[model samples]
Target: MSTVLIVFLLYLIGMVVAGIVTARLASKSLDDFILGGKKMLTPVIALSEKGTDMSAWLLIGLPGQAFKMGIGAIWAGIGVWVGSLFNWLVIATPLRRLTGKYNALTIPDYFESRFGDSSHLLRITASILIVFFFTLYVSAQVVGAGKILAATFDINQVVGMVIGLSIILFYTMMGGFIAETWTDFFQGLIMVTALILMCIVGVISIGGLGNVFSRISAVDPKAALLSAGESGTALYLGLILGGLAIGFGYAGQPHILMRYMALRSEKEVKKAMIIAMTWTTFAVAGAIFLGFLAIPFLRGEIADPEHITLAFAAKILPGWLVGLVLAAATAAMMSTVDSQLLVTTSAITEDIYRKLINPDATQKLLVRLARIFTVVVAIIAFFLGLRAERLVYWLVLYAWGGLAASFGPPLILSLLWKGTTKYGVFAGMVVGAITIVVWYNVPILKNFLYELIPGFFLSLIATWLVSLFTAAEQRRTK
Candidate 1:
């Protein structure tokens, strides 16, 4: 077998081993399976959160956009960095405290408890949106895995996707959250190390920063400009706004925020934030530079820009080293898919099934059902990935916009602002999710700016406006 294939297979096996080892522990209960029993150490919390946050989109989609758009793509990187920082500074400690205080297991559960919503409307609504957008989000990761597998093995994309899905399903189902977190910790390291190495090697290969800039200008001068030097005011503003808007999702991403709740304690948030941001800085910077690096090498030769990182790596690295680096890239995808898989599983088994349907379900039964839904959800995403011809970057953004808009506003307001009502939370979730769908589908609207910006704002507005009336009603009634 080729060294790359061998290395890839070994990485896959290691992930499965991590899952198998953790499975016995995670299988103890629903909380253990989904939240690692809230016993996660600082490093696991930090790395796993970053790993889950970056995904294939970081290595493939972001770099590809950067490659195609040049320096203008830096907005996306900045957005992600700031967004993660926002999560750390603003979202992490409070979410961990609030979730722990209420003993809430999932995002939906938190909503129900926080608002004292006896109607179950808030939980059910939030759960539906989580499952829907998460399924879309998972498919994007599956597509990333398939793309990497196809690039590495020279096989059909569908065949590659199946292989990727099978491995993801096994490890995710077996080890549950603990397995995914431990594996994410390692995968996070691989992603950062490999990307930084690629950046260093790439700059050296191109004769340093000066030569890199000269070469970038030689290829696409506009790409090196912010807004790509668009003359039109609206177009220029849109690029800047849209790029910055990417960060808006950070506050709301269930997969990443879920990590905060899983941390050992609120005390760990600061240390974990430091470690996580360090990884984010190095990895995201490397990815951004790699995009520019590819501009000078594989510009016209590449068919799918999303495959730029893989193609560029194959160009510079030797055979065996290529195997190791590609494994890291694949790690990017797995880290994300596993998180989403578990989160989606949590929504179904804990939020929808156990809470609403079977209030008397046992921990063992819930754990078993979560595993089953893990496979079911992954299979559904696998099929979606097969038919997904869209770029991973945009597909991911669409889903990200939905989740951020739906949950980010409500969660933030509810945690920080005591006035946030359940009716307002429900309104925000609906408006935010629906706006993404409507805005994304309308070509003119999507082309104007990213849906996240408008959706996020509208959701916030909806939450605020609705909360006023509801909060007043509660006061009067009391």
Candidate 2:
């Protein structure tokens, strides 16, 4: 096994150093801390958004799915890429303009301002949902870190978890939004480059694309076919639907949405959309290839399929090169957790504490409180990581479904439909959240489909119906 630990150590140090370097940038005001005062450049926002969205799931979870499910796993890659494209094309510019007009710093704040909800109901409900789902999402990232460390270094899972968790909290506390964004941009590059490099090397080692397919086909006849890897047409249909399920979530993610909001100008988002989509093209293809390539080499031997990326890297790459790949995978996890922590903190500090509790709160005080809440949230997530109830993939999907279902319908509809009422959006969020929780826990329902599919559509229906009912009443009142 490749035992070069120094590369991983250096990567962790680099994350903390980024935070220290950006500390001065975060100290000026709440806007600066939360969104870089809307001054981030195009490349920075583009790659950072990609990095935040990819997470360790790109390297760990997706590959694991492809490793186990064969060629049919492409559904997930397609889902994310198409979903992301939709979010950029449809939601980015208008959202930037709306948030700018409202002077809003967080999603909840945007909700209140956009809908003229002076009752604070929209703001509080949105904030509560953000906190609830983001904390779970961050916990999944923490869990990914532990899994990586344990697999790479042969360390106890708890120790590995703590090491990864502590660095993320420290760096995030040190620099806030700008720091994490900058870190994510760099980490994003490392993740893509490493994943692609591994794919190229694996393809070459396997002799050629033809050989790879034949070998995997030798094991399972349908494994090489993109449309179906299992026996029944029914099984193929299930794979496609379940894989595409989470695509609906891209429009709803607060951490990813924040990147769009922080762009220097709305016009720049077009250029950024191209850059980000190009990055996604490379990253997703690499992940999918990695998983497929590993099926011939590591199938049935590995205990945890999610460890396939690192295990395969150790098998093929040199000692130091493997270390670099390990760092890249680790970077994927850190890039995500830091952003989720900051987004969750903003929900607590900016949306709730300042907007609701004390309108007169100073920028410095709110920033301090944000840092404080960042710690509290990280601590809560750390314990959840220790529990390790599910694999990193499922945990992320559940949280993604909740956030997407609850927030996606409301956010997307309000931006597009003038008739969307505050009460309607609130009701949609509640229904969406409830559907995910219920759908995820029941085995029959969970097996029927990916929870996000039902949750999202149901939420959309609730939003449209409730808005139709309430809009006329609101007009009567006015």
Candidate 3:
């Protein structure tokens, strides 16, 4: 075997060991499995959240966007950064306090408790949405893993996806949240280091920043523009707004929000926020610059722009470093896929099965069922990854929008507005999720703006309007 392959194997073995070690901490109950018993420190929680949040999008999708659209794609990065910062500032502490206060284990459980939904409608609805969108979201990450593996080993994409899925499932099934979060912390460092190294090396390889821009401008003037210059003022405004709108979805994403719920204490939120934002800013900047630098190196020879990072590693870096970089990229995907897998498993076992099927089930039984569900979800996502035809960025964004819209509005209202009722929560989720689906299918609407923008605002409006009437009804009934 090549030296690169050997290094990659070593990294995989390290992750497996991490899983086995953490598995001991996850034996107490479902809470332990899903949230690491809520004892995670600041750094582990922060890095794990960032690691899960960035996924393959940071390494492949975002960079590809920058390469294809030039500096204009910076809007997406800025939006996500701003959104994540605010999510930390506004949602993190309260969520940590509230989840602990209510003894909630999952997002659905939080909703059910927050809204006083004894009927279990909110829990059931939220659980279903989690499973639906998360399956697609996890599939996107799986597809990215397939691409990376295919690029690395010259294997078929389907085979690559299966291999990737097996690794993620094994660790996640073995250790649950403890394993996933700790692995994510390690993976986060690898991801940021790889991105920064790729950026620095690529810039040096292509002469300098000045030469890089000059070459790109010569190849395609439109690709070098920072804004929608010739695309008209309306288009420019739309692009900026749509890009910024990406941040709005951050409030609603279950996978990311779960980190807040898992924190050991509300005091840790401030420290964790600083670490997460700093990491995000640098990591995103590196990914974007790496994309720009790839232009001069590949000279437009590549068929898929998303594979630029992996291709650059294989071609430009030394043998051992190539393996390290490849492992980092794979780390990005695994960190995310494992978290989503755990969340999806929790939604089924914790929310649906426990709440509806058997309220008296033992902690041991629930933990076992969670493991089984993890395998089942991974298999379904594996198939979805094989059949996925869209680019990674769009696929991720599509699922991201759905989760943000469906869960975001209600979540925000529940925390801030005492008047928020179960009816309002239900209305917001349904409207938001439906809006994303309908808006995405309509070519003209999607062309003008991203589906998340409309869905988020409309869902907020629907929730607010419905709350007025529902709150009054709740009062009168009382």
- Residue-level lDDT of model 1, residues 1-478, one tens digit each, is 2888788788889988997888899989999999999997889889999999988878888889989888888888888899999999999999999999999999999999887777889888988888887887888777767767776787888888888888888988999998999999999988888888888889888998779989988988887888876778888887778778989999888998899999989999999989999888888888888898889898889988888887888898777767778888888888998999999999999999998899999999999999999999998887777666464346556888889999999999998999998889999999998999899989999887788999999999999999998998756544
Which regions of candidate 3 are displaced past 4 Å? 209-211, 228-230, 387-397, 476-478
Model 3 agreement with the true structure over 219-267: per-residue lDDT tens digits: 7677677683448888888879877998998999888999999998999
Q: Determine which window of 10 residues in candidate 3 has minimal summed lDDT.
A: 387-396
Give the residue spans of candidate 1 off by over 4 A.
Answer: 387-397, 475-478
Preferred candidate (TM-score higher): 2 or 3: 2
Best by TM-score: 2
Q: Which ten residues in a row have the lowest lDDT in candidate 1?
A: 388-397
User: In model 1, which residue pairs have backbone atoms overlapping below 3 Å?
Assistant: none
How many backbone overlaps does candidate 3 show? 0
Instruction: State the lDDT of candidate 2 residue by residue for 80-107, as single tens digits.
Output: 9999999999999999999999998888
The candidate, 2 or 3, that scores higher on lDDT is 2
Sorted by lDDT (best first), the order is 2, 1, 3
